[model samples]
Target: MYDWTQDKAVRVLTRLASEGLQTDQIVDDIISHVDDFRYEAQMPTFYFLSGLTGNKKVASKVASLLQR
Candidate 1:
């Protein structure tokens, strides 16, 4: 059987972004209401949406954009 919960979460986040929520807000919202996310894919989805602090290159890019 195919799982739909994870795909549902991704769609929710995508729709939220398309509706004009900023990236930081998206992460914050995801964290605050994490219970809405399916447990099976929570960790990976959280990290993918929230990002990698230890990734210097990606961090720098994000920071640079935020600075503008």
Candidate 2:
């Protein structure tokens, strides 16, 4: 179930990225639900997305998200 959830997240992120929408916002929203992520699976993508945004608010949010 955990691995499956991670895969869904990756798929959703990929679709959102390809759509060329506000991916950073989508990433932030997903990170806020970090409990649904696996530490080594879906999370690294969120961390990278957060870093890519270069926004302090997003980075800080994801940092705390990772702590959970």
Candidate 3:
């Protein structure tokens, strides 16, 4: 029942990232929805991932996730 087509989820995540409020839970949530995103919307999700640099582990996970 998750509607990935909506931009609301990505926008909230991006806002959290832009504010330097990213957390492991947030990153995990993003990853959980990776496959749900449309092509155009993926870019903003990538932007959200890019903001999660405070944790090296999360950064590495994001790197590998993007490679897939």
Candidate 4:
């Protein structure tokens, strides 16, 4: 499930970016989850990468998913 979690994290991060989430805030959030055994803490960081593409609503939805 590592790859899946990593992919999910990347997808969410892309969504967050489209939603206009600040880069620093996103970075901080991701970093904070480094030790998290839940929700693949790195997902937010993956989304923050420059090349990832996603929509604002999608990002928000991803964010909601992580919150769950």
Candidate with top lDDT is 3
lDDT for 63 in candidate 1 is: 55
Local error of candidate 1 at residue 43 (angstroms): 2.5
TM-scores for the candidates: 0.39, 0.46, 0.57, 0.34
lDDT of 2 at 68: 73
Q: Cα RMSD to native, each candidate?
A: 9.2, 3.8, 3.8, 10.7
For all candidates, what are the clash counts? 0, 0, 0, 4
In model 1, how large is the Cα lDDT of residue 64?
55
**Stretches of candidate 2 above 4 Å error?**
4-8, 11-20, 65-68
User: What are the per-residue Cα lDDT tens digits for candidate 4 across 1-68?
Assistant: 55456656655765675577775566455545544534454454434543435434335545665696
lDDT of 2 by residue, 7-63 (tens): 566656746754667766766676566555666665556644544454565577667
Poorly placed runs, candidate 3 (over 4 Å):
1-5, 17-22, 65-68
lDDT winner between candidates 2 and 4:
2
Better of 1 and 3 by lDDT: 3
User: Global lDDT of each model?
Assistant: 0.54, 0.61, 0.67, 0.53
Model 1's lDDT to the true fold?
A: 0.54
Cα lDDT for residue 1, candidate 1? 40
Give candidate 4 regions above 4 Å deviation. 1-6, 14-21, 38-68
Over 1-68, each residue of candidate 1 has an lDDT whose tens digit, in order, gives 43567656765774565456664566556555555656656555544544334534435544553586
